[model samples]
Target chain A: MIGRFLAGLKEDKRIWGQRVAGQGVVVPPVGYSETDGSAGGDWVEVKPTGVVTAVARVHRPIPHLHPCAEPFAFVLVKLDGADTALAHVVRDHLEQLRIGSRVEAVWAPDAERHGSIRDIACFRVIS
Target chain B: MSTSGPPKEPVKYVEKQLHLPYCYVAGDYKVRYLAALKDKTILGSKCSRTGKVFVPPIVASPESFAPCDELIPVADRGVVTTFCIVNIPVIGRSIELPYVAASVALDGADISIYALIQECAPADVRMGMRVEAVWKPDGERQGSHEDIIHFRPTGEPDAPLASFMHRL
Candidate 1:
């Protein structure tokens, strides 16, 4: 029920960075210079297109015990403008995927409501 | 015709105030620091090039950025460089209210470290009072910051102003 209400992003968007109070910078700024501390950093828009970096088939139920009757796959996607990769579920069968299968962002209908990483439905294998 | 009684629904409530214990794995440098703390001894690393000593033993010098592996033992007695009084209480803090947290520069160490001072009243604490580490008993030693317990006034005569001027 959690994922049902809180599903994927409708559009590709940028997530801003903020500094933790009283802590110095540990990670290097990705899109901006160190001197521009006041401005924080600039934003670089990127498309949702990315190749599946890795995939895993999960047969066991999650800790929350939501019934996932059939086998599901988890895919790690390296989006543009981000240093790290985003991990989410994929709906395709295990046999359908190659090492570098192309995947695109799929959004749920807006009428269903709300925002978050869940707004984008699971990545489907692109034909 | 309904013959069965009303069905019961499952109830749920949130439990508050969960406490979790955490253990930290100290590296070689940190290990030495903690070991010294058990004896109420303060140790620091000296920068070979700048000859500056950093309390809590930094792996590298801030100024030269050179690797400092030599462990230097500093005298327990030192002067307070700067400090603040903690009027408000924080979770997991052992000390009570009106405690002084000061940056103490142990003798022979160039840089100061933040530590708590005990065995004195808040009004008696000063900017340049000499303080020394108070160690826990040998049996209670645990090789961590808790080993030192807290710092207290040394009650010794203060060194001349010229002695610590250039070092600062």
Candidate 2:
């Protein structure tokens, strides 16, 4: 049930998280979320699009190889409908980075996806 | 310490394999270091207060607790302050067996860099051995430590032990 919104990521779909109230479907629902274990928020349909809140151009190495292996952008994006932000890598649009730049998720290839946070390969600028 | 309860039923469990690969933002200071790596240069940060340098520069000094913004270009040459020789094989390691992971304190820099040491026998690697970064061709370079594939012995005499004594 918690993955319903994120599983949508596999199909390039997005959803707003929602919590139960007298009469409301919060754009970014306020409650406990099971997706990330710490969300402490409820899940709901949200817009796939978002705006970059914070960004970083990454170029470093660890013991293991990473997908965004070379220099790239690691960013935190606030969704159009949700209040909280999701952290993901951003690539192919280093020149246009600015606060509130529009962006969207790029899903992993079918073979590489296993329906977790990594279902999205990285976030990409909307141009 | 065995539990005093009756044996519980073994619940069936499925094998789970998660392959979530991701990136790490080395941040502003390390990014500066990476940019220099592509040009076959090494960089470290110098504290405005204590004058201590940090390899793979950071936001602040360890001792003085002041913001460190000075970008100092460290030399490609340095001594192997310490090292390890891996003899057993690992399934997914890139380098061959019997390689060295060394701590190198570049000339002119106060801090040392932890990187791979190659092109020499495992037994030959030792503390105070002079070595240099072996860079990839200019065209093949990416802003990464990998640009310098590994360090190799410079064939020069080892430096005096006092130079790198604090590193260990």
Candidate 3:
């Protein structure tokens, strides 16, 4: 399921989720429902837009460790159509980031994408 | 079952390389110890109150809770207090499998330091086995643990258990 999800990001610039028996939809599908242990049953596409549910600010970025050198916030984003939130980073507008803040995914350039989680370079605060 | 979508290739593996680089400030005691290693000399910090010694020297002694004020020179040859034969291969390390890693209590030290025992079969390594440091050639010395390639048996009779067992 994750392979197909990553392939969708690489090939179509899309995000994929899975619909489990009990869970509504899980982004970056794990092939099963984490809550009820039921196998995921359907391929679902979630929107790139999301809401910031959690945020942690990094002030002093360690060299080669943090994704960015400038101050940024690591956030949990609940993308539209996904029941659970995905942990990701917000590189800009960190001061405006808060619970319920609107955000959208920023894709890496086509030439730089390699079918990995990092294919979505980062998220930007929209509101 | 739900309707299947277009066939997609399964990803068996995802190769990702993560690099984490950082600097560590080796304080006064450790800096001096590594410097001595380059000269084929081993220095252990001696606790000012209890006279206990620790290699890879620390400022404070764990036993006496007192400052270790003196860096005493110790012989590289020592007795193995205990050891284990490593059978599994480790990534990045070039050492062959089934080698013995032991804690060697260098003469005149209260604690044991870890060292690899080589130049002999794994079965031949034993507690109390006598071993000596095999230093890399002078120019190749880097003042790190790697300066001493590995410890090898000295053919001397194993130290009596009663003499070194307490240091384990």
Candidate 4:
């Protein structure tokens, strides 16, 4: 399931989720429903845009450890069609990032993309 | 309608590296212990009631359950009470394979310290072996355990097993 999901990001610049028996849809599918332990049913493409459900602002960044050197916020974003949220980092406009804030993923350039979570460079506050 | 065949090729592996950087504050006793290392000195705290000494000095002795307030300097040479010949290489260490890792009871210290034994073939490393520390260049010392690269044979006879048997 993870392999298929990574292929989507690397080859198609797309985000995919899976539908489980009890859950509507989960981004970055883990092959099973976390709520009821049921196997995921089908691959579902989710929108790149999402709303910030949670935020953690980091002021003192540890060198070579944190994603960005300057201040940033780690956030949980619920994509348009995904019932669960994806944890990612937001590097810009951290002051504007809060619950219900609109955001969108910023994909890595085609030449620089690899099959990894980092393929999505980061998320940005939309409005 | 029947489902289409599976996708032609699937990703087999996705490589990732995790890096976490952090700082640690060594407590008072450890800070003093590490500071002494730069001068090629080994320090241990002694229990007043039992006179037992422990390296990497602790606040209290487990044996006597008393506070160890006296810091004592122990000899650089000691007896290997127990040891293992390591054949597997560790990821971050550059030591050659088939080296000896041992518990050495430094003179005056009741507790044995974990150290690497080198400068001799693995087959020659044995229980009760007498060894001495091989220190790094004075200028290169960083007040860490690495100040003593490893313990090597001291050309002395093996200590009697009876002398350090309790430490095994």
What order do you get sorting by TM-score, best first? 4, 3, 1, 2
Candidate 4 runs further than 4 Å off: A48-78, A87-106, A121-127, B1-10, B38-40, B86-99, B116-125, B134-142, B149-157
Better of 1 and 3 by lDDT: 3
Off by over 4 Å in 2: A1-127, B1-9, B17-23
lDDT of 1 by residue, A3-122 (tens): 211221222222222222222221112223344434323223334666778888787646433224466778886554334456776766567765588776666567632444555666
Q: Write the per-residue lDDT of candidate 1 for residues B1-168, one digit (tens) a residue.
A: 121211122112222344556887788788888888777677889887888888889999978999878888998778877678989988987678989999888888987777799999978887778899887888898877777777899887765656666544
TM-score of chain B of 4: 0.87
lDDT of 3: 0.87
Cα RMSD of all models vs. native, in order, equals: 13.9, 14.5, 6.0, 4.3
Candidate 2 lands at a TM-score of 0.52
What fraction of native interface contacts is shared by candidate 3? 0.23
Ranked by lDDT, the better of candidates 2 and 4 is 4
Model 2 chain B lowest lDDT segment of ten: B1-10
- For model 2, what is the C-alpha lDDT against the true structure? 0.72
Candidate 3 lDDT, tens digit per residue, A27-98? Answer: 878889888898888887788999989999999887777888999889999999889899999998788889
Cα lDDT, all candidates: 0.63, 0.72, 0.87, 0.87
Error of 4 at A1 (Å): 1.7
Write down the C-alpha DockQ for each prediction.
0.02, 0.02, 0.24, 0.30
> Which of the two candidates, 2 or 3, achieves a greater TM-score against the reference?
3
